[model samples]
Target: MSEIRKIIEDLRKNKAGMRGILAIIIIFAYGILGSYFIMGLNINNSIYYTVITVATVGYGDIIPVTPLQKLFSTSLALTGLGLLAYIFTIIINSFEENLHDIRSGRHMEKRLAEMENHYILCGFGRVGTAVYEELMKRNQKVIIIEKNDEKLEDIEEDDNVIALHANATEDKTLKKLNIDKSLGVIVTTGSDVDNLFIVLTTRELYEDAWIISRASKKESIKRLKNAGANKVISPEVSGGNDIYFAAVQPNLVHITQNHGIDFLEREFEILKKHNCHLENIEYHFPGIRTPVTRTIGVLDEEEKDHFIDMVKNNPEVKESLDVMYNSVNGVHSHWISGPDKTHVDMAIEELKKEGNLLGINLDFKEINEFTKQFKE
Candidate 1:
């Protein structure tokens, strides 16, 4: 019963097109009935007289004097004339609406079909915008599904993106965008619950697509991950990490900032050469002499600079750096080096002063400790 009601509602929504089709049918019927009545009456006038009489534009040239003719004329005038008016009106409105829908539908279908390996971003808020900018910088293809009209208006002018102003959790909308063919999906809406819903919907619809979601609360992280989000991030958690790193590892932060050796930049270079992690064996440091564990995070400025320089000078090194940078997460350990120890240290101190780390740090000792712990 509910399904029947839904079908009825859908039909109502497309009533305009149906009305147009009905109008055409009625017009044809009137023409056929008029032709038959004229032939039966044995009218001597031209076919123009038949058309005029049936159309209610009687010129008095062909009069229906016989009772049968009068009766038929009266019936046709009442029924056919009324139907003609109603059909004309309905058809005009219907065609206009149908034309609009058809054009828009075809355009959407064509665009979706042409898309391949694109990123399906499930919001247009601040975080979503940042993600889009980053993806655009890398020349990645992206499609945005945002419910907010104002937010969508902001991105409509961008040629690189295909924006769908609709609910992200709707299977219809996601399917229209060809989510199954997408490389990944990012849910960065303001609501953690909304993000989770989007993640769940995408996972269910396209089980192989990678999903990254944003969560507001700590508890939502596990749920989002379980819902098939490859990664779940909390803005609050990131902010807290930055604060803690500034307070605890001010020196390291300063070094990283001064040398301009950041994670994103390093990762970008590494992926250019080597596409995967398993292919690389050795990672060179800037000024450090000792060999570092694979799982250890590097905190010193000089060491980070050294690593950056090595990757910059060699193509293979750059490729490796890119791969590692792309793969590393908040949970993994990695090395960071700039040019000189003093410069690195100074930069780290500056970052600490500026509160960039969000209270997170990877000191030499901490790196060693984490590496040992993970190894064991």
Candidate 2:
């Protein structure tokens, strides 16, 4: 049973290659030859007949005359059928494997395209998993680069998450994950220097990507950030903060209640050519109960016209139109903050009215719960 389990694990980790299929073809050919020679069957063109029969291209030129030949023919027929079945099964399995590879390739491509606004989390250990959970709560799209085979199994169960099992600092691995397009990257390896190396490589590849690293030692923080990490967090400092909080503000010592909002920070880039009018607007509204503030950026002539039409048609918006104009950048930027539910409804109403919004992207995550637990 243990050996069988090990075999199963190995099979899951390693896909059957072309060599396996070729081996099946060889076996089938040998079976065809055995059928021909074992029964001493004679034919006008034995080799040619065997080829055609094994190839599944039967011709009437070669015929079995004797009873022995007929019996051998029957055996050959059965063997041919079995070989064909085996060949087809192998071919189908290969095709399915190729299809899966293609699907995974496409998924990685899509993840790369959004790299400019996404995060790459390296390692999938306990700490790394916690970071991933927090990122998920905030509805952040992230690519997890882990090396452990066991962790890959856990991540594979999540259809929404993409996992690449490779060295996070390797250029080839980074390129596969489209590290250049990422908005930021988090290096949380157990080794402080490994995290520093990842940050250095990521910053060099994508200067704009925010590289946040975990430093295991107190002295490594400065070196990590200096190595191009935008921020270096020392676990010791974090532990110190927790200890201080425990000693002083025991009730508020929970990282989840205060720092929980950190996980709630969502960033979205508008999808081009979307029909929703208020799509480009970035609102910081927390929940449905909070009031929202609106800030409008510069608008083009067409957008300005649409805005005017929306304000004129909606009495509520007309009464609350603080400012409406184009900006120096020539693209309109709108800021809306309010009770989450009400503001979202109002924004949607405006979107419906103007038909100008392209898309409303969301990064709705719930990190407070996990962080609160961590604090405890």
Q: Which lDDT value does model 2 have at 344?
A: 41
Question: What is the per-residue lDDT of model 2 for residues 129-235, given as tens digits with 9 covering 90 to 100?
Answer: 76776555334457888877778786643434677778987877777766665545777788886787788887777776667777789889889878987666666
Worst 10 residues of 2 by lDDT: 247-256
Question: Which parts of model 1 are misplaced by more than 4 Å?
Answer: 1-90, 156-159, 239-376
TM-score of each: 0.46, 0.49
Q: Give the backbone clash total of model 2.
A: 30
What is the lDDT for 251 in model 1? 18
| lDDT (tens digit, per residue) of candidate 1 on 1-376 | 6644543454467665466457646654654555466435333343455466557897876666777777766775666577667656655665566678789989877887788766777887877776776555434567888899788876643445788878987778878777776666778888987888888888888877767787778899999989988777777766322321221221122111112224534443432322111111222233333433354232234654576677668788777656653332212322232222344444434445543332234454543443344334
Cα lDDT for residue 219, candidate 2: 89
Best by lDDT: 1
